[model samples]
Target: MSGGGPSRRVRADAERSTARILEAAEDVLAADPNAPLERIADAAGVARATVHRRFSSRTALLDALAAQLNERYVRALAETRVTTAPPLVALQRLTETVFNLKLSHRFAVQLDAAVTPEVLAGLDLLFARLRDAGVITALDPVWCRRVYLALLHEAHDLPADSPVLTALSAGSEVEARINLLVDTVIGALGGTDTTNGLLVRSVRTSASDDRT
Candidate 1:
């Protein structure tokens, strides 16, 4: 038992190192998918050997990170309690959670685009709820949903240090930022009176979609 403290410390440090590597991978890979492992190591403040010890190859690292991200996104949904909240509150909470998820881990956003049918079903419920509440516009649900996904993907193009993102990260009024985007979307959608018959649809994910 005398050696246990040192061992525990070593283990904790290793875990911290691994976490840093994964975070660095997300940030670096999000900007340039082809960024070298050396960049990630530098970002993590760890030796390249440490990263290699945790993930033998770049692909292996991404795959593991994807799994980690999926778990986190699921957790965020649960923590946000979106479904149980009131319509505006639920939308606000979901927007905050999703934008934060994307901001923190771009790779996770890429991985999540390969969404399962169950997730699409959840979106369907959310869209219907918002429709019932007359919050969303009267546009085609499928079209609206596609726009929503597009917005998420497109936002990644913003520089990591963009003033908009800086304010988003530091803002005391979280809803204000989300409201800007949401208001733009709602304005684009117009009124429910203009709604077409097009209902929500499934999200198809080709295996190669993540490569982009």
Candidate 2:
């Protein structure tokens, strides 16, 4: 069916206001999930009434954020080139990307409340695609999804003073740890061997340096 159209100016203003409102809402909620609508409206430089008009209620705003996060997830996954890498490597990269993104965005704290079952169920479809594409192991997609979520959740919670965080902030440590974790999980699933070659290499290298 053909849709009725608003004028270009009206649409543009709406688009701008919506973007501003979402950005402000994200900031406010990230700081405190229970922040009131008036505060969000203030942050957005809009009136409280306008905020309500734009988003009928707190639930509506949260729902919008959840939708925005899923959109980001889809975009990140699409941009990731997993076809050429081994399944484990691809999974590691994907998890690292997700973790890094979450660390930069405080909205991650609201994930538990904002992400509805329907949204998560939709994510299963993406997991299925990855599995079918052989970009991930043939384990239960649900389990894989949970693992991916756990990695992001843990990364978000990692203390700022942690050596892991320091290493990750410096370079590829986050990726390295994620790879190690994936390998461990995959090995436990009997999909591969747990040789711990990387750890062994690190230890051997450290001993050699000490002797030097």
Candidate 3:
């Protein structure tokens, strides 16, 4: 005589526990890839048995971590308007959003997760559009995508104490790095910096027009 579903409160508690465990795992494992579940549970403020209940094994936890990050990446693409915005604007915004994600999950990103081709399908389409529009050089979209991703990984590998970060206050450090990343990506893919200048002008004009 019961609806065959868990109570709403039970579902809410499960969701919170899962989120906490994932966040803690990302931080703990990043600091020590060899970190045990006990440590992660401590970081998450949960019982050690709870971690096991949530993820059957280390491998399972790692897979979940990868899946969570992929979901976040897809969300990032949508939130940044990658599919619908102007190519230049979309590319820059996507790059900025991904830069933060990669850095935030630096260790988890290095794991050999089963990331599907569909996870990157949106980016591939965007790159093709940019190439066709002459926004980028005559390189193949696939190559461009590879170059862009490699650059992002390199940026993620940069140490927190690197001179580039150390030279600026915390508030400005991320901005400076992202600016450098965007410029370098455009240059590497045979796009001109002048287009960026144009993008800036267009954005300002669009904002002004919107207010009228």
Maximum-lDDT candidate: 3
Clashes of each: 0, 0, 0
What global local distance difference test value does model 1 have?
0.62
- Give the TM-scores of the predictions, in the order they appear: 0.64, 0.67, 0.81
Error of 2 at 206 (Å): 26
lDDT for 14 in candidate 2 is 79
> Which residue ranges in model 1 land beyond 4 Å of their true spot?
1-10, 112-121, 134-144, 154-177, 187-212
Which digits, one per residue and each the tens of the lDDT, describe model 1 over residues 1-212?
Answer: 37689889999998999999998898888889889999999999999899999899988888878778667656665664446544444544566777787667766668743355545555556666667678775546667666666765545455556565454422333433454445445556563321121110000021123224
The lDDT for every candidate, in the order shown, is 0.62, 0.62, 0.74
Model 3 spans > 4 angstroms off: 1-6, 159-171, 194-212
* Tens-place lDDT digits, model 3, residues 63-106: 99998888887788787666676676677677767778777886
Q: For model 3, which pairs clash?
A: none
- Report the error of model 2 at residue 185, Å: 4.2
Model 2: per-residue Cα lDDT over 42-141, one tens digit each: 9999878888988998888888777777677666555543444333444545566677767555774356654556546544655665577554565576
